[model samples]
Target: MQSPQYLRNGEAPQQQQQRLPPHFHSTVSVQKLRRFNTLILVFRFASFCFCLSSSIFMFTNSRGSHFPNWKDFQAFRYVLAANAIVTLYSFAQMGISVWEILTGSTVLPETLQVWFDFGHDQIFAYMLLSANAAGTTIAWTLNGQDTCTASNAFCIQSYLSIAFGFAGFLFLGFCCLLSGFRVVCFIIYGFRFLVL
Candidate 1:
């Protein structure tokens, strides 16, 4: 028989098993956390690839009449520059992530890293979004009534490049979310610590 001492807490063994403490943890297992971090690393790398490809696509196009390359339009230049910056940032972050996964060391304090990543991500996300909007808007405005015109290869290429830029923007959004989650977790833990 179960000891009477177990019931002194005022619950049966089965009942206690079913009821979690009010402050119970909801964290993922360590293995799962590693996998999640690796997954984010892969995703950020893919984002870097997309940004690089988009930059190449836009920069190489010379078919447009008015504008020979991405530099011709301030919006296109912005897109190219923003994507390049994001590409570099993603690469660096990927390295940090890999290092963290392997050795459990971070360049910054855990909370600071989370906040730093979140802030930089928000900034870059905004920049990428704005650049994408500007580039796509200008591309469409240049296209006018023509529906992806066959004659204007530059116009078509511009659209395609902008599409790639949009893809990069999507990946950046994912990075932002991951970093934002880290920041949120840090904030929650800070609050809990204060409470305790």
Candidate 2:
């Protein structure tokens, strides 16, 4: 007995139906975001392990008078310490993100705060690593003169140490740059949230 609701142009009422409820879309978006965050955490953990292992190898195997002397060993030890510190810091960041995701509290505000924290942590870690590498290279090179003693063996080791140290420093620098970019993106998002 009752007529169907229609638009002023006579369209069917069903034509005005929304594709999805707001809650449904929000749930899906949150799930996807959580998955992404989890993946990043996994990658970061893996990287930490790799760096730690490499540092250990440099410290343990690359030693002795026939190879590197006590000074060289000391340099490698410093590098190992730096690597360990960075790994721990990264783990802490990952843990925080995981906690947020598990609690279903990973909103824009929380994520932005995490980003800011991570950026600062990353900057410090990277700078420390770079400084450690530079110091190690300088010590190894200067001490190589005494250890190598015209055999060229110490010179070769010194060059190898320099190469490895520089490579590590460059890699950390690249990571620092990437973190800076992430911080910028987070700032933009935070601004948008505040504006809206």
Candidate 3:
């Protein structure tokens, strides 16, 4: 005779279905990839904003300050102009990135193709940032001897500006590298998909 407990319940046996882990599920969405790309673009745009505002502040405030001398002022002007150019370039890059993500256009030709396209853009960014850092360092060193100025204040501000600018550029460069890596991976995965 069947067990009384099973008869009383009058239920069929339950079956357990297997599922992929959360991490596996997390990696399987095209929508999630688009969202991540958008987030990165937003972050880069924010960095550009910071660079623009800081460049403006440095240009305007340095003109009024007595420590930077006339030659230093000219250097700062160059730096300001470079920053503006880079900011505009960054905006253009962001626009293109956003469009690509929206259109689900991750696949590209040879990895060199994408690298050349994005590399030129990032090279300009790096040049501007490096020039800004070098100019500020020189200005600070030149102004450090002014006895009437507060102790080390000019030097500190200049150094801080250089540090922040370089850090930002480094982060931007890393992102560019990561983007190149992603392109390579896409190419490899695309080939595998075709083979399968």
Report the number of the highest-lDDT candidate. Answer: 1
Better of 2 and 3 by TM-score: 3
Structural similarity to truth (TM-score) of each candidate: 0.75, 0.53, 0.61
Model 2 CA deviation exceeding 4 Å by range: 1-25, 62-74, 106-112, 128-186, 191-196
- Indicate the worst ten consecutive residues by lDDT in candidate 3: 14-23
Error of 3 at 150 (Å): 8.5
The C-alpha lDDT values of all candidates are 0.75, 0.55, 0.56
168, model 1: CA deviation in Å?
1.1
Tell me how many residue pairs clash in candidate 2. Answer: 0
- Global CA lDDT computed for model 2: 0.55
Q: What are the runs in model 3 whose C-alpha is more than 4 Å off?
A: 1-29, 63-74, 106-113, 147-164, 190-196
Q: 59-117, model 2: which lDDT tens digit per residue?
A: 44444556554244555566556665665765675676577568755544656665765
- Kindly report which residue stretches of model 1 are placed more than 4 angstroms away from their true locations once superposed: 1-28, 63-67, 145-151, 190-196
In model 3, how large is the Cα lDDT of residue 142? Answer: 64
Select the stronger candidate by lDDT from 1 and 3: 1
Give the per-residue lDDT of model 1 (tens digit) for 1-196: 8674466478777777788665343444445556667877987888888888888887887755644555667998888888889889888989888987786446777767777778888898788889989998888877764433544777777777778778877887888887777666668764111122
Candidate 3's residue-wise lDDT over 1-196, tens digit each?
8853433246443311233332232334566667656765875676577556646555544334555432355665666666666667667667766876777553444355466546764686667666776677576566645622643554555555455555556556655665655556547663111111
Best by TM-score: 1
Q: Which of the two, 1 or 3, has more TM-score?
A: 1
